[model samples]
Target: MSAATTAAGAATADEELRWLADGRRIEAIEAISVSAMARRLPALVVRAFRLGWRIDRGAVGLLLTCQAVSAVLGAAGLFATTGTISALFGPGRVEDKLAHAAPSILVIAAAAGARSLLGITIRTVTIHLSPRISRAAEAEVLRATVAAELTAYDHAGYNDELEAADRGAEVCVDIVGEAQNLLASLASLLGAAGVLTVLHPALLPLLVIAALPQGIASVHAARVQFLANRATIGDRRIMANLRWYIHVKRNADQVRSDTMGEFLLAKYDQVGRRLDASSRRAAMQSARVSVIGAAASGLGGAVVWAAMLWLVSTGRMSLPRGGAAVFALTAVGTSLRGIVGYGADLFRTGMYLDDWSSFLDTAGGHRLERGTETPGAPRRIAVENLGYAYPASDRKVLDGVNLHVERGEILALVGENGSGKTTLAKLLAGLYLPDAGTVRWDGRDTRDLDPHALWRQVAVAPQDYARWPLTCRENITLGQPTAEGDAAVLRAADASGAADVVARLRRGLSTLLAVEWMGGEELSGGQWQRLAIARAFHREAGLLVLDEPTAALDPRAEHRIFQNLRAVARERAVVLVTHRLTNVAVADRIVVLEDGKVLQEGTFAELVAEEGGRFRELWDLQNERTGVPARRTRQDQRTVPDQRTRKDQRTLPVREDEGSGR
Candidate 1:
């Protein structure tokens, strides 16, 4: 097997074992005991009921009334049946017995019919309420996920918990049915038990004994299945991700170009096989337990029947009472089985709901809890002794970084990859909180400001901006349109050079940006980047962070963007991060960073004139690559000879030769 497959399999096995251990702990708590189930049953029922009540209170009330009425009718039907049996068995003329049993027969029919109607009503209410409950649960999960801090995504534990909560949301609807089933079963059990007690007290205990073995088997089987499902969670997630990669239109071209279809399918198959193996093992174990329990149940059933025979054979119980006992015993047994089955199902679903509830309460333990102070658009954003390290990482992405940008100033951050340029810009924009020091907006710390309110004043055109599958207008406005509306969108589009792109669209501003939908169209990489830039331009924000804002643009569009940037920055503090040193000329000040620390800070002319500096070295190298003469101060122009040829300029060394004053 390939290393990827081998590693996946190993990780899956380890997770499966861990989940199995958790299942064992649950099993210990829920072992076949009346006290255990009784303790758990009330809480699970109340939780389900609370959810149902929240969704549709009328339906919840109707469901409860129907179950209660159905149980009463069931008990009434059994009593009428007993009366009919007693009349028929009495020592009397056949015609007389038939006449005496007539009313009892009608009563039984009425009770059965009423119970059937109640059952239908119960079903209707459940159907009406289940979907609403499911949607509400899913909505709550989405809200919690959205409310969580951005840094929450950096931790694997948070993601795993999120997946579990999502799964819980899906199964949340099942708890409604399970809770109702359990209630109905309990009602039936009580009515039957009561009837059996009236018939003869001995029969109730005997019926329970006969049903106990099967009840235990059902609970054990459910636990096995739950454990199996828990074990396969990681494998299932892997399959889902792999399937998306293999099936999505975005990856379709690459899958075919790289001949990756078979490789992806093989990994999928590997994960599927592991899941199948666990399921099969669990099924086999459940079957073994079930077979043993069935045998024990059969023996217990025979003992109950023998006891009934003894009661009848002795003059202790009448034939009519014995016949009623038979009916009551069957009812009790059915109810007991229903209770065990539904209770097990309810418990399983409750565990899933617990995950959902826990996530909502803690948002995977990463809920945002910033201050209530909502600051207005910042006049000056400052970073003082800023330091940051990503969750679970020892290496700092930014450390001791101090910079400031005021309104109307364009500060350019230039750095190589992993040199913390983007991280520094994000800190300036209040996207992340520094661990060591403060990022302040107009004198107020960002940490002391409401995150949502703070973010409203910050606009970002990131390197990897989203290609939102929305209308062109919506994409530009980001669903938060200003009072100017389409006019604002158009102006921003024009500024970002996306006006021409929008004009070519079938619906102009109304055109959907995804091809998967009807009447929608896809944009080229450069076109998409323009829309991204337009979104940033459209936002009326105090701070603007543009990271590689023109990476995908053509030379003309790139030049246009930088040429107009200073004008755009007149009302906001613009922090631009780019590797293209040529673009830094647009900024009032340039800060060159290397290894998370400032290497140089100056104007484009000053940095380029400082010979042997990192910025000067980089500037010369870029000039060499493009066969352009390096920017020089008037003093340097006088000291160095002009290169004679384009070829010589292209081959110019980064370092000037000392003592060779050409």
Candidate 2:
């Protein structure tokens, strides 16, 4: 990369890193504590269950029922074990004892079988429900993104929030399994604790004491990993972006020709190494905590076993009850360990889900809030004292600008790069609202109109139009076909010079535009630009905006587009923004902009007649480069009316009168 390019990339990377680190959830993770996790755990579990219930209530209901039944069966099996032990000890003959124990053995087998069946049912329901929960979460994210104002994308923080929410959506499915395990573990612990209480109240407390250390260790390990993940979020994002640049097909040629593959790979490795270091530190810390906890837990278990022996020796618990205590203690201990492990996983997942939920709640803090007024096709669209500055900047892109366009007129915007030509065009189309003055359709301000309803009357062929990976027909119509259907699409294709390109496609208008797909085809740059223009032409709107519309077209195609421009403008107002001054000859009037202010405005002939004007200077520069004559003859210029007489005939300023088709 050039030095300037490298500097720009570094600046962007720094901004992104700052944004990622400033995330609300990242800040929360930095200060994470066991007490905070405990407080948040209930709300997170409730949210997960609510989400599952909303997506598929039947599956959620089935899952809960199965868990409850399985817990009951587990408790019954423990009770049956106690009965069998008691019967065997109460025997006269060995044969008599075995016979008496048979009924209890039968009950134990039945309970075990039922519990196994219930476990299978729980797993099946969880599998059925998890994906739907994920899909619902993802869909909500998409909806919130779409509802946000166009200006929302200008903020780095908003983009960072979107990335985090996407990760949260992806992990949403894992929460379902975590929740099921947590609930099952809790239920099992309760059942085992109850059985042990019936055997002896003293033994229930022993079970908790034995499991406490391991439970604490599990939770601490989970906290360590979660914090590590949060710390590396920015680095992971950087790595993902680098991988895309190195792996995408569009960059494949540049990678080889510029010898950038190794450099890119090295950058990727650098980011990956940072992430790996964080992971290693987390793993070692977790291991240390686990080892210490295990040693403490071993000591606790010895104490519990010794207490049980003393109870049995003192006849506080009989031999039959002692055997049952062994089974109950094992069950309760395992369940407690499971409860801790699953709870920790669920808490971590819940933190990520909070990102998703928070974004949906605020809609990236830029959700659209426009008026309810629906506008029809406007006869005249007006701007007065318009000004705007993009997010995160004080520099105004368009300041104190005034302009208008009416139906049946074509107004051209001409300027050097960064002169706000495209920004002005966007403002006129209601894609953005001005920071200072009003843009109005007829007499109503744009802010007073329903945004979607207003946009329905506008069509745009932007400088960087999307190359939709869809069928040619869908690309042209943008998935909104007219009643005329194919006839309308064909007419638009012919007008934009894309009919020839479509005819050469393997499946004509049905051909897919992405080459990566099976049986799909790709288009050259010029061909894609033609399709983009056709998309705007296909829409039956009251206003049409084309920015650098012919930038990629050949001379003949460019000529054809300008030749048809006046006819297209006969039905709707047209705003044309381009650097190709020759094409502006077809415009009814031209406006020159410099540094966010209008420098000149007139008919093409009038602008050309002004000797030292910006337009004439640009025209002369282009003429010299193309080896054409620098100026028209005096008599040729006289053929056009003088600007003095034209101004005398207008009652309003040139900006409004010219747009009024005077």
Candidate 3:
């Protein structure tokens, strides 16, 4: 086949698979009779029962018991009904007929009353079990999804499956009830079948034949409903996301600022139109199927009545027997129709449950391995030829990078935006595994150590740190809950210059941090950054990685943090990743990275001493912007050009200090 044709065929195949997942397509009703559904009914019924049984075995058993009692009562009532009718038609005195029917009248009354009581009991049991099923299913889904590998969230397939599984959890409550009702219907059906056979064996086949068309219709309607559900799910998610964007407190400011209301509504309407159109089409198709089934059912009923009348006239069946047979046939037909309807519901629910099953299976494959080994506090961390690329991406974020940091030393990483500074720091922090090389902590590979154990020894504050909506004390203590009170918290705050921010709060540490909530207060960008820094400091881990830690801090606050750097490093290693070159002056070592590769590594003074190196050139450019001349000796000053000549030389803004790959 041509490529275009092949692609179309593949698309068609996927559509077919989705249809088959829920059984046959709606359009196949004419090609496949009700007999085809018989083969799959047993499996769907069993699965539905298994699900209900797992949620609440007691409820399942109670429901089945009620169904059994109802079925037995219904059968007795049918026979009593026949006995009463036969006595009414028998020859004798009026008194005699009344006496004979009176006993059956009481029997019928008892059976009817018991059936009603069982039905009520069934409803009560369902009420008790529905919420339990929903809660259990939701918990299971959340447990798997929350623990799934972080990389799984990056893929669209995982997101779609998650949405479907969430919907399935909600439907679980109804599925259990439907399955129970199906069981009850089957019981009623079997009871009616036995009655019809006892009255006259010839009538049993007619009951099955009468139910075929309605069964076909039920299957067809179910398939149409499933198709509509699957088709609109993605669009519904988009609409939901748009609604959240429009209505949530967090996005309200931006929505109003950018006047995004109209744009978002437009997108919502666009998806809404497609969803409405699909729903209308599905409804029309389902209605047509129902009409066809109803017409066929009417014809079958007519044929049955005609056959009964013919038999009575021919004397092949007695009047009372024929009457009872007609009643039994009607009951059997009703029960069979109910069975088919309930089966359709189970089939539809099974498709949604399939989504849940598939999500769990896929998540299992991607689950992060929990290592068994644990290591002591690292004396040194080494990155040996480390490389990393994000999932489904071709370009590497860190390429063949090598570095090391020792205890009680400060290592500063300086790089421009998108230069792999954060990615490298994350590798060193054991948050990600290298694609091609190893990160070793005191000669033990990070992959060999339990991730949870390794994470306990490290702390990180990224540029976009979380601002938890909690009390200030809770936020700070969140980093180290075991720390004893305000003293330790205030100490970390003082180190990061966050103490001043806390000192100004209305209630100090007791103040709620979320202004959006009632009786809560907000923090400015700089204050939040200080709090984040305080959190990291409170961790007191063996190693700390702070990415753009001073991004929101003022120059004075940044200077204070740098000045306190020596004291913070006295007990553990520190790695600072920032674009601000001035922050590196306090570091014992500095590494410059460009385009995923190490450009230079040394102390600040050593790098600045090189006349034409990349680090020295960057330093000179920054100094020129700040009106600080590069340091020079008396002999070098004598060689400098005169002021007027220098002014002319500056016209083109040429940097004579620009290095040529030295």
Model 1: pairs clashing at backbone N, Cα or C within 3 Å: none
- List model 2 lDDT by residue over 215-300, tens digit each: 67877788788778766767777888898899898799999999999999998887888888989999999999999888888888
Q: What lDDT score goes with residue 318 in model 3?
A: 88
Evaluate all candidate structures by whole-model CA lDDT and list the values in order: 0.86, 0.87, 0.82
Backbone-clash count (model 2): 0
Residue 263 alpha-carbon offset, candidate 3, angstroms: 1.9
Q: Candidate 1 lDDT, tens digit per residue, 224-314? A: 7766776677777888889999999889999999999999999889888998999999999899988988898889888988998899999
Clash count, one per candidate: 0, 0, 0
Candidate 3 per-residue lDDT, tens place, 289-386, comes to 99999899879878877887787889988898888877787788888888999988877787677677766666534556756688676889999999
Angstrom error at residue 146, model 2? 1.1
Where in model 1 is the C-alpha error above 4 Å?
Answer: 1-34, 626-662
